[model samples]
Target chain A: MTRPALAQLVAVLVRPAAARELSLADWDLLVRVARVASLEGRLQATIEDAGMLPDVPPAPRRHLHAARVLADRQHAMVRWEVARIHEALAPEAIPVMLLKGAAYVMAGLPSAPGRQFSDVDILVPQARIQEAEQHLFVQGWVCEGYDAYDQRYYRQWMHELPPLTHMRRKSVLDVHHTILPPTARLHPDPALLWKAAVPLDGFPGMYVPGPADMVLHSATHLFHDGELENGLRDLADLDALLRHFAADDPHFWEHLTARSFEMDLARPLYYALRYGNELLQIPVPDSAFRALAVARPASPLRGLMDGLFRRGLKPHHWSCDGRLSGAARWLLYVRSHYLRMPLHLLAPHLMRKAIKDHRKAKREKSEP
Target chain B: MIAHEDLKARLRDAGLAIQVGPFVVRLRSQLDRIERSVALFYDRQLLPVDGAPFADFHVTLARSSGLRTVWRPQARFFLDGRSPFRPLPLAHAYPLFEWGLNWCIAQHAHDYLMVHAAVLERDGRALVMPGEPGSGKSTLTAALALSGWRLLSDEFALLSLETGKLVALPRPVSLKNAAIDLIRERHPRAIIGPASHDTSKGTVAHLKPPDSSIDRMHQQAGPAWLVFPRFSAGGSDRLQPLDRAEALLKLVGSSFNYSVVGGAGFEAAANLIEQSECLTLEYADLDASLGLLNAVAGGPA
Candidate 1:
């Protein structure tokens, strides 16, 4: 590649915030780095056919080095946060399951730092959130102001707890609560989550989502929430699972299907796998997608119509509403209200919520 | 009514114990572990510049997740109920604590300003970066940290309105693909861990805070400079001063709870923005950024 071309390639790979261009040399370097084989020759093979990396030297050592740096940082954050959680929940002694990133770190992957974690996800018994909060308070964690109405709406009606803020550290923790908000229409209780949780190797009180459940949750989070952008990573997670866990257990697929059905996340799982296989070359069985109704809508025209509205249409009935035009906007507002409370109690709930919020806003304004 | 003894029994059932500075908090019958962390343990949540409580309030809380299910905020603790749904995973607890606390203050205190940014110091001056994810905030923070700046925290840089001291809680520096490699090559001895791929955010790697940074973890620094650093793959390093108002707006936007703290948080943010020289930095090369930072870090007060 020429200097300008290489620079452009560098720009694409590095994504530096300021400069929008890369030199030819930069592109050559990036191409070399992309071809490195730290992961069983995966990178080498992945980039082999791409013209960008043709005849390039082995990928740079910086890739592994970068992975190590991220791993360390993530580990520190996870460990410190875990310890802090331990400190916060000392009273209830309810065992906290180190979900997602925490589990990833505890299982050992220090080179995989900067895993783009938005929040530290964890699962505690529903009975223990308040107890959990009390423990955190003494440790310099504070709660952001929400009117009593909003608080009640969330506490009484929502799935997880409202987000929590650490007073001194200021790191945000989303003290969830139930994976699915209580108000969710989905069937089945969250208590089953504990049944599927397996303890971490050395951490006595902590656990991880079972292999099957982990895949299911990832799919649900990705598809249920319109996670189209991070599809690559989400699929990568499943691939990582196949590579890491499938070898140990032959019943993985059966368990995965059973759990997906039990949790009502089968469709999402099927699509994740199907797209993953198509996009990233994850080799999931065709039978899986065939078993589920993931045929991308029988009518292509109908599918397009459905896709337009279903994707960004109204946010409330996002699951069921197929038509694009009508009370969609109003439905979303209504949905937020319902999300804030059950339908029958919507009117009174809104009244109470409004009063509470007014008072909170007043108080905050008056005090500081 | 559930007596104090009953509450104690419920707490015992849950099995919780916590130590905050010099206090040992035991939650026997309480539903809120975090409330006690602030109220019962600390006479006041915010310490003034003189190290005294900022206000007459003991503590406050605000929650958004469990309203319909766990809204029973009685002093009477119920430890026997099983949630109908799976609780959030434990990995989320720390961020939850931070967010919950923000709600409490934003809804209740209305007396402070909160800015979303990370604060680090070297030679007594603090570098504040306020940006969203994918903005290269964490990447820049890690690069600067490995280059010899004291990392206050990659996630938060807490400024106690009362004490005028920036609280240092050195945590992990999250890095993405290329930045991860850059840091590793830059600091071969750095400690890193497995990268969790395909998260809602993206591929993420966490870098352990440098041991030296952690060693000076408790040492607080005053606000010095607030610079929002953006990494451009191969862009030249540039740093330009920003006005207090614009800088404050940028910093507040990065804050997890600026509106909640209301004036106090705003004042705190405003004070820092005014006291510091604010700048926006865009760099492609760590070396170039490091050179720029070294000059800035070493320059006269």
Candidate 2:
């Protein structure tokens, strides 16, 4: 069974009044969920509303306030970085399309409020990505050290260039040509995403992905990537985006399913629909249910994926983790690497990482 | 609050849950040495169980035993079931916990403008000493805490955003190297913990905080004085006024979250410097330094 506390916390997040009252024990578990999921700052509005009633206490309120402050600071830093990136990319005329947290904040989406932004992401056209990188270099953004092997790997197989950091500010910028890596089975055309980009009014030369693409990108990043460290937070983002877009567009669900098919992202969309509805109770339209029925895995594979994702998406709390969770995470990790690279490259990379990690642990344990 | 004997028993069993200034620490250990330190140091703060399983940082301290036990047996600290750093010798267990507490604060408490400084209150005024390690901030704070001044904190100076004041977080003062002997000789009756030599920072011991400071822990002080202290042997005692802008920059540089707090940090810092008198003090003798401090506090020397 899903942890009862996890279920209650998710329910309360979706519909705040669902929590009639909570004991100190419940608040304790919620604190861990909020912290590990990085939702403390994002849940400020709900906390403020909840605090007005008798359900909240001073200790929990303090924790919520702390998170809200961090979110506010993060939002400020993101805005500052956007201005600098726009200055750098403006000269190249590279129609910057912000992705993820940067996009949510720029577009003034509900998901942006109190969101923790770690780094800024931008999308440029594939043809001019090199020129864009050169322009950023002149503006003091230097790419991280990539050896001959890594340089070849990224140039030939990756969708985005290696991440770059500013010399003075030390802020990170991830420039992308497409949402998914080129090595992936799904080959999404960048032109379609660019053509549908919505420009922000005040911020000239900057745009965010169109409504359907935004949700699809979130789904692909969460499910396809190698790391599930922030899986729960990413799921929360998908849930919020789906709900927001549905409210804005009457045909959002239909359009999203069609977009998924055209972009060759049906697998991630199916997973998103199934879990978003099951976990966060996002309103799934008839189109989504019908699409999931056709696109989802068959019975045995479906049962296995169900087991993996259900455990994988919850925050890493001991109370919620079962014996199977560790193995599930490991399997998912290997699966991501397999999906990320061909078997030849994948075998060596995993072996190297294992040996390096083992040596580091042993060295640390033996230190004075 | 739980009785001291009960608290020790709980530590031997499940763990001892204690609240230390805005954070709940759940500590578990089987070592008798760690238990004695717990009884001597954290006796006042352990909370009675209220049937809640809440803790911000869960850590375990265990003494290593084996062939290596004869020569420098060590104490290992674990947080969230992971060890971030190497073990210290067993005699360093008490300081290990102190440093661990600071680590947890630095990692999680991003809500406040945390400055690496010593803060103490006298005459309803706060004295903030922002300095680097081995800069006499801790030693000066210990002397002040023992001499009738209410100690706010010897390590972290938490600047609150909502109230726009300094929150008090008093703990045992850590004395290092020559300062350890200085405090022991000067105070005479000082409760100095057993010293552990050859630490990364040299020999270190802790001075137990005066009981009155712990009793008045809830009191937050308004900003009044900003003192940047540096101790030099055979040096003259001097406290010179510093420019407001310069003080703001130094405070920002010393802060843990000044950049993270964005505009709020800049504004709060400017407000603090504007209301307080900023000075830089250099001294060799503790008596001379305390006299200058009293003069600044409007007391006859």
Candidate 3:
């Protein structure tokens, strides 16, 4: 079947349309015009009342309704799950704070209502991750599989533990070893998370990451990899954070930058702020941003480094389509490896991982 | 001075400039006709709107005719929803929309190999089982996720392709008929949603993803084995290997839209099915089968 670009157009436009009010005829025309964009000829209107101006608003009511409905559902799920997590982890339990979508939900933005959460995110001490895993396992948490090779990469080589899944529940937990990948040379310590943790009322043992840390996590998570897919949502979160917490302290940027430097995530923090300001119209004072800017990569070399960094955040397919060369790929791979492990141990560690992945693949094949 | 119209009023007041595709739809003077046309395209009754401003964020709801009822993005879900969202949500009403949206925006970004499978992980590894309804996928998924393995999803298992993180969206594990009784008999503490009856499909009930799964919901998993499970009443207990092409096609078919993701989707699907050992399990015995899965999942660790 010849692929339908119409579907893509629809996917892109439908959401926009829902954002505003369009009479049936307007929507119909909008779709038609989009389809005919390539046509060299002038377009013709088919409606009888073409001359009459459509009273439809710029955006549709349905779009907002849909966004709100999804957002509300997301909030309820986050609220319910966060509360449940607090209850289950108990009083002596590790402090867990909501990250990304969960944080946005608590921040009380209308965007929170539409923000979709595929899985709930929380931060726990790297040491307690195993304990957390076991605790969750006994309580019906099932680990989704990774072979010995894959397992080693996550446990010993990478920053986080392999994601833990539940058999009965449709949720997955991303138990992190470090907030930033080990290779990024950034470690937003879990202890920092605990120190700044804010308690949810009535949930004696439960806590969310403090405001500063929460905002940092949001920036880091959104900007760590390129914030392509959820860019708008990230912008919304930054907007929310700026409006909510910044109001209390005009020096929120100081706390934010200090924490980023403390964690060595200033580069990612810079990128997030830059893109947020550029795309979402978030306002970061030039002076504040200047202090945190990642040192410029060498000219000519900078373009390569930028692409490499973006690729690291992108899907493998993106790298391929975007034309990441083998040499560049290898360099980027090396960077990722370094980010994942201590600088001293990265080489041999990655070599071991490559061998292990091969062995694991062979083992899986022999099984069935 | 003229008062600004409310959002609803604008729609009532605005003239239509109709266009569905290349052809412009004839604008109707009456509001009744516009509502009917919008409804006709929207299979499910619900329409979520942002009410002005962005205008592009609107989504129409649609449900799968077969197996479980999932509220999918009207355009994308039908093509992909059936294979990916099995045992579907108990009903397309609210929960489905809520859970489905999260699966799309947040979890899918990482190439986490989003599977229409339920996950149960123990030790550190997880077993991802993707399948269609009546395949006994959920019953087995529910049993394993609740038993010991972390419940990745009774509905959708989010596996990251990059970090190989299997993110869990443990909402409600939906069960039909005997499976509901089976789970109740097995785990008395299980919380279940109300059973919806005489649905165009069948009598359906939702088992809440175990409380702990909900509590520790952000668990990321690396996929070790990809199993397409089928629960037959008297079938032999065997986990057979599925070929890569077959496995990929089956997975893509089972996906909400293997096509939508295009090449990246293709690569993600290929990478996952390629790396993991593939299995098609058919069995009548739940307990014995779960034992097999546990052994398979827990073997090396």
Q: List candidate 3 stretches off by more than 4 Å.
A: A1-64, A107-111, A225-228, A293-338, A342-368, B1-301
lDDT of 3 by residue, A112-204 (tens): 534555677776777777777776677666667776767876786556678777677666767664567655656666666788778766666
Which digits, one per residue and each the tens of the lDDT, describe model 2 over residues A1-368? 22677776787777777655766667766766767777777666565555543456656666776677778777877888898888988876888999999999878887787677688889998898999999899999998766676666677778888888999988899998988787786788889998899997777888999999998898888777655777767777887788889988888888899888898888888888787778777778876779656677799998999999988877777766889999988888878888888888778867866786798789976865
For B1-301, candidate 3 gives per-residue lDDT tens digits of 1122332233344322222111111221223322333333211212223222122212223433433223331112211112235323323333333344444433223233455776766765667778787889878878876776677667566655446466665555668778888888889987665565654446667775655665565556566788888777777788788887998888877665343334556777777776688888877898778777877775521
Off by over 4 Å in 1: A1-71, A109-114, A226-231, A294-368, B1-301
Judged by lDDT against the true structure, how good is candidate 2?
0.81
Per DockQ, what order, best first?
Answer: 2, 3, 1
lDDT of each: 0.54, 0.81, 0.55
What DockQ would you assign to candidate 3? Answer: 0.04
lDDT of 2 by residue, B81-133 (tens): 55777778887887888898888777667667889999999977898899889
Interface RMSD, all models, one decimal each? 23.6, 2.5, 13.5
TM-score of 3: 0.45
Residue A84 of model 2 has an lDDT of: 83
Measured by lDDT, the strongest candidate is 2
Instruction: Write out fnat for all predictions, comma-separated.
Output: 0.00, 0.46, 0.06
Q: Tell me the RMSD of model 2 versus the true structure.
A: 2.9
True contacts kept of 3: 0.06
Backbone atom clashes (below 3 Å) for every candidate: 167, 0, 103
